[model samples]
Target: MLGIKVELIDKIGMHSSDTAMIFLEDVKVPASHIIGEEGMGFTYQMLQFQEERLWAGAAAVVPFYKIIRDTAEYCGQRKAFGQPVLSNQSVYFRLAELATEVELLRSLLHKATAQYCMGHNVTKMASMVKLKAGRLAREIPDACLQYWGGMGFTSDVLVSRFYRDFRILSIGGGADEVMLSIIAKEMNILPSKKK
Candidate 1:
């Protein structure tokens, strides 16, 4: 499922632009194109982030599952002291835990999307999903690659590639701290006192 690139001339996937605006842009294009109902661009952009973030989370799910599988295969084949590396429970279960985390993140993303589509306010949900996905993207492949020892450091292994590639999820979708701040603002958790 991963590494399959589609040939579509769509800017949404290219520059992380939202599909909603792309459609809107197509219908109404002018030399001076300022979008939304005057000062509502912030709200619209937040909504767009929800969709883009959910798509990002969905894109990561399958590749993460495959990481566990590939790691298991590597452990099974790799030997140390004439015993298969997978004979160690820690190696296998750590990855199982990572897979569980990946699934949990996916569940949150799906739930957020469903709620948003049902006309519920999903700002908090979106922030949560983006935050978790960012943290997971950093930790999962990093931890999985560590399981491979020296091979994880080499370009020959897919784990190495995953390690190199998955780092962008946090910074690209929105930095992890940015999501936290947004969620806090949504929940009125940010400190404020009347002057």
Candidate 2:
């Protein structure tokens, strides 16, 4: 495990300002808590972000897979017009397609994280993973909810909990827009762009 933990020092919109500060403050440690070299802290922190973001991206695939599978099961078990809802090709195929997308995104995130660990240029890869992960964070639950119809909206459903939990990925670690800015900066397309 890495020897660092990042806490957001700013929160606007949803949560309270004090909540953000509380996260920022965390708990102070003794001076001995420092590890390795003092000057290397930024580098270590950046690397930690890479690993953390990659894990956050890759982790989405499992619950996404389960959501699609369980939605399929629900559709299959529920009867419509004396036949199962899964009988409809549109519904089942779309669920399968989303599953395939989750797999592809997982692969991309893993490969990018590997490149990052190797000390290669990985800003584009990282941004791509972050962007895709955020999109999937929204897409997976929305799709699952659609499949469940009214039942998905209720708090009792397992899918509802996933819907709420996965939402933090985009804005929590770093907003999707923030990742885009990082990618743009790395690509020399922002202020650094030739004018």
Q: Write the per-residue lDDT of candidate 1 for residues 64-141, one digit (tens) a residue.
A: 888889988998999988998988888878988898998898889889889988988887887787778778877888
* Candidate lDDT values, in order: 0.78, 0.79
- Please give me the total number of clashing residue pairs in predicted model 1: 0
Clash count per candidate:
0, 0
Off by over 4 Å in 2: 1-20, 23-30, 34-44, 191-195
Give candidate 1 misplaced runs (Cα > 4 Å): 1-44, 193-195
Clashes of 2: 0
lDDT tens digits by residue: candidate 2, 25-115: 3465667997978789888887777667777787787888888899999999887889988899998898888898899898898799789
